[model samples]
Target chain A: MATKILIVDDSKLARMSVSKLLTSLRPDWTRFEAASADEAIILTGREHPDVILLDFNMPGTSGLELAAQLRQSHPHIPVAVISANIQVEIVERAQEAGATFLAKPLTSPALAAFLDEAQARLSVTRPSVR
Target chain B: MNEFLEQFLIESRELIAQATDDLLALEHAPKDAARLDSAFRAFHTLKGAAGIMDFDAMGLVTHATEDVLSTLRAGDRAVTPKLVNNCLACLDQITAWLVAMEESEALPEEADADAAGLIARLIPSPRPEQPAPVPAANPGEPTLPAHAAAILQEQIEVLALPQDEGTPGRTAAAMRVMQNIFTRFGLSAPAAPTEPATEDTARPQRMDMARIETLVNLAGELIVVKNAYGHAVSLAPSPALTKLQAQLDRLTADMLRGVLAARVLPLRHVFQRFPRLVREMAASLDKPVRLVTEGDATEADKRIVETLFEPLLHVLRNAVDHGIEPPGQRAAAGKPSPAIIRLSAARQSDEVVIEIADDGRGIDPAAIRATAAKRNLATPEALAAMPEPELLELIFAPGFSTAGAVTNISGRGVGMDAVRAAITQLGGRVTLHSTLGTGTTIRFHLPFTIMLTRVLTVEAGGQAFGIPFEAVVETQQFNRKDIAAFGAAEAIIWRGKTVPLISLAATLNLPDTPPAGIIHTVIVEHGGEWGAIRVDRFGDQLELMLKPLDGLLSGMQGIAGTALLGDGRVLIVLELNEVLK
Candidate 1:
């Protein structure tokens, strides 16, 4: 089964670019996009994606807030919060919300490392039947 | 261009336009929260876009602007004109980079330098209550000292060794050892796995200008051949040939129209830059002035649009420097305190008319005459005999300036003559009109395109060359007796004025035959001075497309470009300014 990933950002261009990067890094993984935190939350409930990528800056319900909310309900999924403005306080908040902090202009290696870790955890907890 | 970059350019340009509009609106009503929020969102999105492209320098600039805007949004800092101007400057830099990326499909080489300068300017003053924002640090990588790394390696190696059943606690013991090492080195262990450094393998494909130029040249050559074919058919006067020729003419005309349309761009690309510039200039000069632009949507060839900035900048500087009087002087004169400088462009039948008008002190013809006489640019009798309009034209004379003291703004050796020369090189004409106290207007009449050039071919030393027809004032045959020697130089009298003369053959260091009786000369004007060039004979005038020299002959002085003639010969065109220099 292919792993499903959700990409969320306020800007459509940003979402598209991130989706492209993710596809190049993991060709077999499935990707979904949302333009806001609300849409992302709705999609998460519907798709049950294994991993989530969120943009920190948005008009309503910022990425960190949504990350905290999702952490409460879905404790098993892995989350990464991305932003161009990476202040120390923001990093601390992301950690407090049980999410990983990634810098913007996300390189392939960075996304690949996160996905690799998620894949290992998934394999150990929910092994596929042969 | 790749699809990704094409999309980038299109989206970034829209963002820039939106940001510029919001900023301009905010300048008028600084307290408008809606505009402020809109502007902030624009910058934030632009920053995100820059980040997605891995344009680090562009990211740095937009990030700085975003921080400043956020501070304003938080009500911590009040909106100021300086802040607005700085933001606009940042957008201008981004726009410049976008243009470069569109042309080359790669990051600009000067991005770092531009970013550093702009970031310095964008740095906001520190508030006593809030500390300055710290520079971002990479959180993923936790570097270790060489000795500490060695110690960790030793522990890992020890753990890897084979052990008996009694040494089952070896893994736990090695973990304790690593904790001790971390404590001693004053470093915290990484919270997550570290990623190895990876090279970026994605390189955007670039569009080649040389290929495009070759295609354009081929198209021009085809047109020339088609014209020749028509001529041949005309000579024979065949009905079938005439029908074929008419069909060919229609197809060629359509192709030419398509090509020319692709090269046309709106004037806004150049006009949008003046608002920020005028603001800075007004602030520096301590004058209350406003800039009003009209007909920015008018279109012109891309070459004309790109080459217009410098000359227009000089003209605007002059208008702000000498044309506009001080606020106190304006108040005393009962005119509006904030003087207006209007920049307008309109398309004429086959030309574009651009005018920069200033509603301030106009040119005083008497002052110009007095200055001309004092500078010895002309005799007192000549200055007295000249009309007012002719006297006003004296400002364009080289080394002729009426400013009492030189200011850094306008009069540092570059005069109106340079502006005229630049315009003339583009097959354009510039004229100045002024009323005593009402206003002054500088108008430029420019061609719609730059591909075709009308050249007057001349032969010197048995080799033919081309001179731009616009630069040639007139041609005359002077008797050898009339040519007088002046200190190893030759001079000729033309229209009751003594003009210096130089032999083109001698200047070019070519073998020449000495003249016997009369010298065939062409009088050319450069930088407002008339000089005669002696040649063997003048050839037929022709309109041809000029191709700039490339590869080996690139940057060659005194030669502008090469044009192909009808008989398969190459005509070398001269850059008159450099040649005369």
Candidate 2:
């Protein structure tokens, strides 16, 4: 089965750029987009994407809070928090939630590395499916 | 332009508008935390967008602005007029950059200098009592511990192989490696958690104005085709054909209404910018004035809403510079300080009525009379005999200025006359009412829409043309002897008044066949004056979707636009006002 990825950001341009880069790196991966934490939560439940990429700073709820929540409910799924200027506190909190931190503008190499790790984890955790 | 760049420009403009609104509101209520937060978010998002686009200068400037906003948000700095002005100025620069980017479809060159200047202004100066704080490390570089770093490297290799079964064993294997790494640092592992979700699937698509305009044009063409169909059915009338024609007429009317409504926009688009303008103007003129707008939600055709800004700006300038009295004078006149300029709009019947009322020294009829005489606009006896209302009307005459000395704001020769001319061109009328000591009110009575025009077709010099029905007062036939020649001009008596009579064919330089006995004349009104146009014959009345001439004939005077007649012929519509002038 092909892997699925969910991208969340308030800025449509940012979301589009990430999707475009992800497509170039992993053309077989299916991509789902959300513009807010609330939307991301709903999409995660419905799409069951294998990996999730989120923006750190949003209007109502920060991505850190959402990442923490998603980690509790879907521990097997890998999540990455992406932001332009990643502060130390945000990175620590992301780590505590077992989520990866990636700096933006997201280059292909960093995203590919994360995807490689995510794929490895999925294969080990879901060997029956494989 | 590429999609990302186009989206950036659109989103940047929206953020700028949002930030401007918040900043302007903050000027009135400095303690409004919500507005401050909103403004901060807009700047933060703009900064992030700039960073994504690799616009280093814009990112740097917005970052500086965000720092100041953060200080304000933290309650460390108080909002001040200078702060608001600097923010607004920064937004103005960003607006300029966005415009350049839109034109060039690339990052603006030479933005570094402008961004540096704006950043300098955005960074507030430290007070003498407080010392400048040390700069922190760049947030982009976060320091990580060795063990935590090991997990990032170890996880890649630990999860590299696929297991056939024993999912629990594999999970334990991954956790055991993390546990062993944590044991080396004498630390514990963290646990994870999740939740339920609600669904919302309301997604609205945004349509650009050009696409909407294309739809409007198509709707207009459909109207023309429907009219042609109706005409064809009329030539050979049958019960069935008549029924089909009626059905087609109703459907076309409904679609046209919908299309035109799509072209209608709220007057708020034009009115929202006035409060800030009035604030700046009041500060500069040293006159305390408040701009209060009402009925901003009233909608009008997009063209009307857009074009209204210029004429309204002229009126507002006049109201601020000449209409509103200074604070001292206002108090001496037993009026409250900070004079009010009210801009209100409403839809009445088929017209949109906009009124700009100012509470200040109104136009003095005697002063207007003196100015008219001084400027030699009329004879002294004529000025003296003019009614008070007629004397006040002199303020709108060309080159008329009642200001004792020229002011930079309103008295550089473009006066109320220009305002009147602009309104007139938009198929609107401007009327002014002023009470000597009380105040002045200017009202604009404008048409609902300019799309579908009702024209009366006429044949002149063997060519068919259209005259806007609103301009035609009445048409009549008179004997050639009734026209009396005065030197090079001719005059005719109509309704007990002498109106100018001109041959339309001759005016247009077309071949003219003089009337042998009786001549067909169309009496027209333009700018409160009357004129009669002579035509070869009068034709049918038509409701046409008038398209303004473009390219070579864009600015051609006396021709308003072209329209298609029901019988598949092109009709040239005349701008009677321009023709008469």
Candidate 3:
């Protein structure tokens, strides 16, 4: 199976910029976007994306809350919480929820490291797909 | 130049306008919570978009403004006109920065100073009870985190406020406190602005008017070629050829309609900008006026809507400048104190009628007559003989103005003439109507669409011409004996009415046909003027794409545009109104 990614951010520009960067880096990867956490959850269920990049501050069901829900439902899938506001509380909370915290605006090197880590984590946990 | 960045710029521009409008609305209904939330959201969205593109200056300004809006929403701060003005100024600055960014892929050099200035102005005038002193960072070290750095810089600028010169700053200390709290929680520093991989970035594309025009033109060419092919194959028609032709015809017609539909846009795109304009004009002129627009959702061809902005703006300026009375004068005249300017657009059959009406002292024919005579536009007797409507029409005459003094806005006498010329250039006509004390209405009748026109082709003077079907009332075959010479012109009796008949060949300076035989005449009407132009013969009516004449032939009075005929000949579409004039 090809690598599938989902980005959930209320800002359209953030979604587009991140998608462009990801596609350029991993040419074979498929990308999807959702503008809200509710939509993000629904798309994740339907697409079963391998990984998710979620924004921290949203109108409702913020990234931290959604991260906990996804961790409970799909432990094998990695969720990277992308945020502009990164406090220790959020970072520890996200970590406790079995998700990683990534700072934005996303740069090339940081994104590569995150993806490499995600790939290793995914490959180790899932036996059905390499 | 990347698609994401380009989209960010475009979306930011729109959000700035939306924020400004909502801020202004909130100024009126200060307690409207929903409107307040909407205004705050616009700023928040703008800040997020700017952050994505790493537009630090824009992001900082919007962030500060968002904070103020949030305070208002939380009922911690009052919504004052000063606050609204501050918000509007921030929107204006963002708009300018966006424009600069569009031109050069970065913000302007003075962006920092402008943001600092606006941030300084955004600080509440009244001081909070107790201020927290900011912890000084070590010299030559960057102590603040990235996100806090932007806010810290703004707060440092706030330290220079004249009234708060000796006061300790809460903003910087607040940022420090937040950063320390985050550090205590064991979180890493905030992310720096991302530098994506160096690749060629294509701009995000939208369906703008120029691209639509190209599509429309291509569709038109397809039609012309299809028509030519049909004509060629008709001589030796077969079942296969007929079937192919029918399919091609349906495909091309569908393509043309689809392209034309894509070019339709609601008038609100143009109408929305005017509320801001009217508000500014009201403030500058100190004249209380209300602008009411109707039928804003009416749609028109994209090209027409784009070209209408200037002409509509000119007429509207004229209404505010010359038509509307001052508040004092209006009250004395027993009219409403704040004058009303109503701009309404409606689709009337195949034409769009736009009316700019104002409730004020109407145009005086005697004043126009005096101006016309003084400007040498007409002789004294001629001016007297000119009826009230015709006298008012003099306002459109070049270099004619009845104003005794020239002001900043409209009195240089150059407005209405240009308005009429522009409308006429688009193959439309404009007229004026005014009662002594009621008001003045300037009406423009424009073609519903400029791309394709239905016209009747006529052959005169050994050349073919296309007459718009809308102008052609009827066609008659008259014997030469029925035509009578009247002074320098000729006339014919048709349906108990005497219509002026002029030989098309003579008028066009073409080879004269023999007058001894039957004459073909096509009657045309343009703005209450009816006449018949004699032609040699008539051809089939066609829906043709009108391509305006170019270069030196562009302004030749009677030629509207050129169209390609199926036989590879060019047909001149006549400006029948101009010809009649």
Interface RMSD score of each model: 1.9, 1.3, 2.4
What's the DockQ of model 1? Answer: 0.30
lDDT of 2 by residue, B257-355 (tens): 788777877787677667767776787678988888899889888888878887887899789988899888888889987799999999998799999
Poorly placed runs, candidate 3 (over 4 Å): A21-29, A35-45, A50-130, B76-85, B124-205, B208-214, B230-250, B344-355, B376-392, B401-405, B431-438, B443-445, B484-486, B511-514
Across B529-555, the per-residue lDDT of candidate 1 in tens digits comes to: 578889999987766677767887677
Candidate order by DockQ, decreasing, is 2, 3, 1
lDDT tens readout by residue for model 3, B501-539: 977777777898756788888998876778888888988
The per-model DockQ list reads 0.30, 0.39, 0.34
DockQ of 2: 0.39
Candidate 3, fnat value?
Answer: 0.48
TM-score for each predicted model, relative to the true structure = 0.58, 0.74, 0.76
Q: Which segments of candidate 1 are over 4 A away from where they belong?
A: A1-16, A25-130, B1-25, B29-38, B53-64, B67-78, B85-214, B227-250, B402-404, B454-543, B547-562, B570-581
Candidate 3 local lDDT, residue B255: 86
**TM-score rank, highest first?**
3, 2, 1
Chain A superposition TM-score per model: 0.94, 0.94, 0.93
Task: Assess chain B of each prediction and give its TM-score.
Answer: 0.63, 0.74, 0.79
Q: Model 3's lDDT to the true fold? A: 0.75
Interface RMSD of 3: 2.4
**Candidate maximizing DockQ:** 2
